[model samples]
Target: MDINTICVHGSAHKTDYTGSVTVPIYQTATFAHLGVGQSTGYDYSRLQNPTREQLENVVAALEHGTDAIAFSTGMAAISAVMELFEAGDHIVISDDLYGGSHRLFHHISEKNGLTFTAVNTTDLLLIEKNIQPQSKAIFIETPSNPMMQITDIAEVAKIAKAHRLLLIVDNTFLSPYFQNPIDLGADIVMHSGTKYLGGHNDTLAGFAVTASNELSEKLRFIFKTVGACLSPFDSYLLIRGIKTLSIRMERQQENALKLAGWLAQHPKIKAVYYAGLPTHHGYEISKRQARGFGSMISFETDSEQTAHQVLERVKLILFAESLGGVETLITYPMLQTHADIPASEREAKGINERLLRLSVGLEASDDIIADLEQALR
Candidate 1:
């Protein structure tokens, strides 16, 4: 089936006794068993819920994974994956990743005895050189947060296989409509479903989609044990959001391409980091691995003063954190998203005060650009 059809009807499970088109939210803490031993496959909400299961199934289908585990937020999903590694295990990860992920691995995971080596995953040699004898997995976020650096998934997967390590790809930026890391040899795919998968800023959700049953089983055990599963209502919200994923992604990318092009030509804008732009460093790699460049655009302004001016002055384009929604948001990553990182390190990655990240929404391109035009002036 086409991705559009899948997005709309993928969650239609066999247990849908109701004639309604949408998946009904099984809003319950526990389900009564047919008998003491017999079960309806869902005994508890924490272990599983009908609605969340439907969500998991649809996401699994989209990512071409064996199964997907939904969580309260993207961070929860990542935390569950971290539990898969034992003490003394090391992981190779992308350097320019989300601040929250960096904080978790550095503060929490390291405390638990796991170590991480952060490198620019875009360069295969940099990744390979940093791998340690204790390395158990390689984690990467292609089109990494704020910076928008693209890593070749197929090439990275080959490196992981050669080293006998697991390959985990964070597919939050591009979403399944644009990229399927599993198809490119990722052992596991991660999503902060709070972003594109939800398609709206109203709800929070996350997912860990596994390529094999073994990984699915492992993550499921950790997920249920941690008890951070998504609520039935949020699952329904995500389901509703995902129904329009195809159309929203299409329109959002359309708007992003236009905005990126305009920003590149503007004198106040120093550089535009959007894969859709042929001049972007990651253009060819993104083109080969993903269907579209996605709706994220990060641009550097002429100075910190200009960056602040645009944030304060834009009317239609909101000055806010978070992305992958129906409303265009312009965020200052240095203070908002990646603030936890040390000053020197954050600035080194180009997420300084002069940088702004834009989450292009499903709006008329002219209106968004016009708002920026007025703001820049």
Candidate 2:
């Protein structure tokens, strides 16, 4: 089926209950067994739920993967994948990663003995050089947070295959509508469903899709054992959100492109980091890998004072930490999202004090642009 059709009807069907067009939420905690050791597909809510299963199937289809597992939050999904590795295993990750991910690798996981090297994964040579004998996985986020750095998924996957390393991509920014990393040869694709997958700020969820059965089993084991499964209610919301994903993303991307172009020409803007902009360093590579340049963009001002001024002045866009909702959101990476990272590391990665990140929404392009224009002035 085409993507549009898949969005509306994928992994869901009318049930006998009401013959409703939407999938009915199976809200029960546990399913009754027919007899001893004989049961329906589900046993307990924590292990699986009908609503969550529908969402998993939809996300798996969208990502072009064999299976998907939904989680309570994006961090929970990341932690589940990370659990596949042993204490001594090393990971090579993109330098300009999401701040929460950086905290997970640098602080939380470090105490458990998992070491990581933050490198520019866009440069395969640097990534290859940093891989150690114990390197088990290549973790990356393309069109990276704040910086919008694009990584070559295919190239990185090839390197991972040759070196026997797992390749995991955080596909939160581009979402499945814009990019499918599994098709590009990634072993696993994960998302902060709180963002694009949910399409609204109403729910918190995360998911991971795997390309191979072997990897799927590993992830499933970790997911079940760790028990961070997403709630049935949020799963229902996520499925509904995905139905309008393509259309919402189209408008958001349009607004983002226009805004990026305008910001580039503005005198106060020192740099605009958006793949849609021709001058952006990642524009060419991003175009090759993604179906569309995503709605997320970041820019830097001359001073931190000016950055705060812009955020305070912007009336239409909300000031918040999360992204990929129907409403536009603006955040300061240095203070809001990337605050956990050390000042020295953030500065080195160009996540400077003057940088402001925007998750463009499905608003009128002209209105959004006008709001930004007024705020900048």
Candidate 3:
């Protein structure tokens, strides 16, 4: 089946008794066993819920991995994956990281003895130079948040293999609809299903899919121990949301290309970062690696004042934090998303006060542009 067909019917397991179209949400804390030591494949909700398992099964199939695990949030999934390392272990990471990830690696994991080094992952040499003797893994976010940086997943995966390091790619920006990192030699693929996979921004969810059974077992052990798995009801919601993913993403990317082109031509705009644009450095590589350029766009204005004016005046695109919904959203990364990083560091990454990120939604392109034109005026 094609990806669109897989998105809908891939994980539809045998619905023996009910024959229901949707996977029935097994909303229960515990399931009854027929006899001593007998089980119905599910023993407890925390360990595994039927509804959540349905989601995991589908996602695993979608990502072309051995297995998948679902969590309450994307961070929880990441946190569990981090458990693969010991206290003294080190990891190489993308310099343009999401603020929450930056926070977790430093404030939470570093305090516990794990260390990380962030580098410009687009350059393979930078990654090679940064790998410490203790390095156990390389965590990456291609077309990274706010900045839209792309990394050659296959190249990074090769480096990981040479160093006996695990390669973990955050596929949140593109979702599996646009990109599948595991297919490119990555050991693991992670997603904040809260963003694209959930589609409506109504649910908070995360997932990790492992390319090998060995890694899957390790992650499953951590997942069972963490007790931060996704709820059964939310699992159902994510499943429904994924069914329309290809269509929603098609529209969203269409809007993003139009908007990015317009921004590049705008006199008030200083820079635009979008992989779809031919001017972007990673445009060709992104084309070779993924199915489409994602809907996320980041651009800079001539001044901070001008950026704020647009943010304040936009009547159609809501000034918001999260993305990947049906409605358009505009985010101020310097403040809302990347504020946790040091001021100097953010400025160096081009996430300065003049930068604004747009998450184009299902709104008509003309209406969205009209709002932006009015706001810019």
Candidates in order have lDDT scores of: 0.94, 0.91, 0.93
| Backbone clash numbers for all candidates listed | 0, 0, 1
Please list the residue runs of candidate 3 whose C-alpha ends up more than 4 Å from where it truly belongs after superposition: none
Local error of candidate 2 at residue 293 (angstroms): 0.7
Using lDDT as the measure, the top candidate is: 1
Report the CA-based lDDT of candidate 1 relative to the real structure. Answer: 0.94
Ranking by TM-score: 1, 3, 2
Clashing residue pairs found in predicted model 2: none
- Residue lDDT tens for model 2, 1-377: 77777787877432326667777788888899999989877899898888888899999989999999999999999988888888999999999989899989888899899999989988999999999999999999998997999999999999999999999999999999999999999999989999998999999999989999998999988888889999888988998999999898898999998889888888999999998988877788888999999899999998888898988998998999899999999999999899999999899988888999999998898988899889878
Q: How big is the positional error of residue 190 in model 1, measured in Å on the Cα after superposition?
A: 0.4
- Ranked by lDDT from best down, the candidates are 1, 3, 2
lDDT of 1 by residue, 64-104 (tens): 99999999999999999999999999999999999999999
* Residue 231 Cα positional deviation in candidate 3, in Å, after optimal superposition: 0.3
